[model samples]
Target: MIDRVPAQFRGVADGVVAVAAADPRFLAVIVNGSVANGQPDEWSDLDLVVVCADPYRSEVVAQGKDFAAAAGPLLVAFTGEHVGEPRLLIALYGPPVIHVDLKFMGLGDLGERVEDGLVLWQRHDSVQQQLDATSAAWPQPDAQWIEDRFWVWIHYVAAKIGRGELFEAVDGLGMIRSAALVPSIVARRTDRPTGVRRIEQLAPEMVPALARTVAMPDRADCLRALRAAVELYVEVRGDDVVQQTEAEKAVLGYLDGFPA
Candidate 1:
């Protein structure tokens, strides 16, 4: 299955390059996003960044639509340029919708401001220095911010669940985002990643037992998850800071209004 998809991607990529190469302004071509991140699932899309000498050149901008259409009868959703960077979102005529985000960057203008990107093709040594400098500046998740938001967001999740707002409740949970911080803290405490998935998988036994503190039943599982989420937040935070605050109190009051 993977072998077949790459073949299709190659065909589309080759067509894009062939059209792009016709113009001398185009300096290089890069493919980034999930595909470059080494985490492509079956649903992943081909995110291509077209690096050119002048990204805003009349010829390049004009050809953007045509370049996308070269992918055959696929439905192309063009998101235009962001801060002068052109983009396209495409879905091919296949079961798995293939998304392609195209960005045009100028050679001389490519600088330290950009994120770490792969150099699929390069015309000169200038892009090398910029790519290396940008790579060094990759954003690391802020530990203090994550720690502060954990407790505060849990109360919001509880209130959302209590109110029967499932989508908002799930978003408020932030399990995946908060989970990233836990592994780092746990690694510091246990000296290993532990390769756990959900917070419950690696939650310490010594933390306050939440079974009695949080109510649960067959119908209110989302509320259970929300309460468990709060307990996990308290566990990860430790005594580094107190969970109780004016904002948390207000959120708890809001949740209290929605009786179990």
Candidate 2:
């Protein structure tokens, strides 16, 4: 599997293995994301899960920069706190730049993961054993959960449009696409409802509607995109979901008051 790693990333992956192999604290260095997902290309980023002994995980994460620097010519590195993952060290490496995410986790933490990773380097077979013992499951979007919030969000965006806050209105539409429609659309093509990821490849039929959601910060354009978003959401939201009829009616009526 290591051989399948793209040429541009091979060096960094090899460097990580070489460094991790010698480190007693690190139990395993597993590669995930596009590489492990079996769809890696030249543009793919190297995502790694560096398993450290439970006692040392904090220290290892604290000094993640040092470990990343040892593995490659790290140009810039930052903890993934902004993304709500403090354990992740997002790094950029090279004269030929490549992005890598090094997530330092305790050995026990491997029990819960979104997907299986390729065991690049391990101190023993324990890593594989743990992986075999547990299943990797990505969380699916709950239709009902989206349904409850959908009308509320639509009303919020409508208000923004009415107030002539085109910038906020445009951004709100993008959020709707990502949070509601994109996942709903992607779900139709693949079991994995990855928001907007590879939408063209995964759900080509929805491309025209998806494109219509993109507005140029103009009031009329935002209103049009908002209408498109509503229609698309209704189309993709499966028959099983409960309809928020009254709320939908109120929101649509409110939005109708807006001048195109």
Candidate 3:
């Protein structure tokens, strides 16, 4: 599979796979994202999940630096922000400076992760069924999931606005987009809910316009973007949001209570 992608990424993949295959602490290693499901291209990062037995989970995760060293000369390493699972080491390697993400998890919990993951190595056959039946498809956001969160998120942002906290408001807006709006917009499509990353390539029809929703800390600008986000959500989702009308209206009216 490394041969399919650009030359720069192949060495990184080669090294990681070699190191992972030789590690006794791990039960299996899975390759996910583009390499797992899509055709190769120039830009791609290696997304690997290292499935460890419960006894070795913590010790293995602590060896992230060693993993990086094994991948190649480590340039820099850091823990990534929690999207959901808080178990991953993010690193960049020098000379080529390729990005590598190493997610560590126990063997039992491996089946719960829903993504298109192609198991590169499996030390034991107990979880063979798990890999063969991986949920690997990108699921569309359920309308109920959005409805439950959207109204509350509006209030969360409104509170940030009320407190005069522009930075939190900005970050809150991004969370709502990534969590609710973008996924629904590109539902049934191959697009990932990656905030505004590669918007032109992934969500061209919807996100280019949504980019205008970003705003300054000022009340009027934040409210302006907030309103735009609502309009886009409704336009894309329609009847799915009808139940949210009264709650949304309550907040829409509540926005006026803030200084503008």
User: Which candidate should be chosen as best, given lDDT against the real structure?
Assistant: 2
Number of backbone clashes in candidate 2: 0
Candidate 2 error regions (>4 Å): none
| TM-score list, all predictions | 0.62, 0.95, 0.80
Candidate 2 structure, TM-score to reference: 0.95
- Candidate 3, residues 172-237, lDDT tens digits: the string is 888877777776676656545554455567767876558867888787788778878777877766
Question: Against the unseen true structure, what C-alpha lDDT does each candidate score?
Answer: 0.55, 0.87, 0.73
Per-residue accuracy of model 2 over 82-140 as CA lDDT, tens digit each: 97999999999997999999999988889898888888788988778888998888878
Residue 186 alpha-carbon offset, candidate 2, angstroms: 2.1
lDDT of 1 by residue, 1-260 (tens): 12323554766666666666666677777766555656566666777777666545556656666666764445655655443444333335332345566665565445633355566666676667666655333334444555556556666666566666776666544453345335434544442243343335455552244332333333276666665655554555544444457766665576557567
Per-residue lDDT, model 3, residue 67, is 80
Error of 2 at 32 (Å): 1.0
* Predicted structure 1, TM vs. truth: 0.62
